[model samples]
Target chain A: MEAFHRIWKKWRHLLIYGFILGLLIISLRLLRWKYVIADQSLEIYIGIVALFFMGLGVWVAMQWFSPQSKTAEETESIPGQEPFSIDEKALERLQLTEREQEVLGLIVKGYSNLEIAQALHLSVSTIKTHVSNLYSKLEVKRRGQAIGKARKLRIVE
Target chain B: MEAFHRIWKKWRHLLIYGFILGLLIISLRLLRWKYVIADQSLEIYIGIVALFFMGLGVWVAMQWFSPQSKTAEETESIPGQEPFSIDEKALERLQLTEREQEVLGLIVKGYSNLEIAQALHLSVSTIKTHVSNLYSKLEVKRRGQAIGKARKLRIVE
Candidate 1:
């Protein structure tokens, strides 16, 4: 089970790198055997070994470079309020209550409504009222639009 | 301006390919120099070229084998539903009227309520009510939740 989990974790990287390496090996062997072969059987044997190594090399490289496996701490993120200034302006224009702004931030990050309610500790209805008020203030129609405008205005960085 | 554009269009492929080929040549020279003195330079140079050609061959192979970008027609879609289905559901649950669904779809796609109102021919307050309804139905308490739910369900795909 542990071995299976390990393989699943690294599968995407392994697949990409393995395929690239396999291509490299096959081309190298074909070229070598075509030009350098004196005996047919000998050339075929060398070609097979070269192909295997190439495939292995690619798999290793992919494992080395897979981006999805990076931990959160290693990921890049903007620090603090500097990114929120534009959003503040959008919020002001939208006349969103303070609570709505907080919720809006999570929305941009792709959280579900249930998740946001849990985070804010507010009744879903109250949250809805604030969102509605915000929609009127911003003169926008859709949630996607609200998020986009907030990002554009630096309201929810 | 036209002459410059024409020239750019005509030679773009040549310029790009040439630059890549030039880089390969330089890499080969560097690798060859690391191996030996002038006595073995010719043999080393040949080996380096072979490596460079092998690299290019592998790159071409990868391009050939990789999946092509998806087209709109190729996308799997659910029938008899708005493109943003989850947003529609959230809107319905919130008790937003027909106009609200239109506005919410636009918002999730990154439009402002005002723009949605203008497009939908509704008053700003009406748009606000719809947005509020969307927030409540999604139980998010914010415009962000509505949008996030929409995306998760492939409503925007």
Candidate 2:
């Protein structure tokens, strides 16, 4: 019973979501069987799917742009919490070039791409190329993610 | 200067992502102009867009399912936190029926429709209808989201 309780705690959310999705798909099929033709049913499916994704994307964007859990105090305390030092091996494994490394360092200091380009005597396009390449290699889509991964891997302090 | 610095800190990450997306779209258009036929170019555009969305979905799913910030201390302290009570005003604002509200409560506890149906002594189809109607009113796709909104609004503790 104790183990069942623990398992239920872990599995309930995902299971409920899966069950709801199954119900949705089953009902869509029923609608098609009763009323809609194949092509119109397909269109309805696509439209509903698109609308669902659009709402999901909006929810995600809200989470991203306005993080709920992070307090102002946490943000203010971040720089003081660490004396970050770069990890050269970690940098090498990420395949960052010397120029790209310089760009990333500037990013850690909160320099915008345009500002980094000016400082490095490179074009904005050049800076963007380096940034995107490094982001891909770091397996992160956002700047915060790249910085967080770098800090975790000891590539930056 | 201080205000500008603060604004830059807030907007920089989103700006960089937007800039990168713009570059991707421009490059796709250029590729179409220089190499591919119109029909094939359109297909490529759709393919790339789909790929981008799929990657974004993966990233969003990671953010949703694997929240990184909850500390051990927070979890341990949760029981000591203030007692959460249901907010009737919040429930009324969502315009949920009594049956729909019952389904939402079950959902918060991670109940599958089958389980909820068994407990409520209703058919699974009836439970599904109630769940779908509530989801539409809540404007969420997943059970996690419905629960999140409910907790946020104090509709469910």
On DockQ, the leading prediction is 1
Candidate 2 lDDT at B55 equals 51
The list of candidate 2 runs beyond 4 A from truth reads A1-85, B1-157
* C-alpha root-mean-square deviation, each candidate: 17.7, 23.6
* Sliding window of 10 residues with minimal summed lDDT for model 2 chain A: A72-81
Residue-level lDDT tens digits of model 2 in A16-65: 64565467456545654546545554334433444454454444543343
Q: Candidate 2 residues B1-157, lDDT tens each?
A: 9998987766664566577657855655565454554555333443344335535554544333323223211232222345557788878888999899888876664455664665565668998899889989998755645765776788864
For model 2, which pairs clash? A84-A157, A85-A157
**What range of 10 consecutive residues in model 2 chain B has the weakest lDDT sum?**
B68-77
Output the worst ten-in-a-row residue range by lDDT, candidate 1 chain A: A65-74
TM-score of each: 0.29, 0.29
> Candidate 1 docking: what grade?
incorrect
lDDT of 1 by residue, B1-157 (tens): 9888768645654566568766754654554455544565433444444444545544433322221211122122323344334444433434655665577678676777777788888888988888876664443444554565455444443
Worst 10 residues of 1 chain B by lDDT: B65-74
Docking class of 2: incorrect
Interface RMSD of each: 11.7, 17.0
After the best TM-score superposition of candidate 2, give how far the Cα of residue A2 lies from its true spot, in angstroms: 54
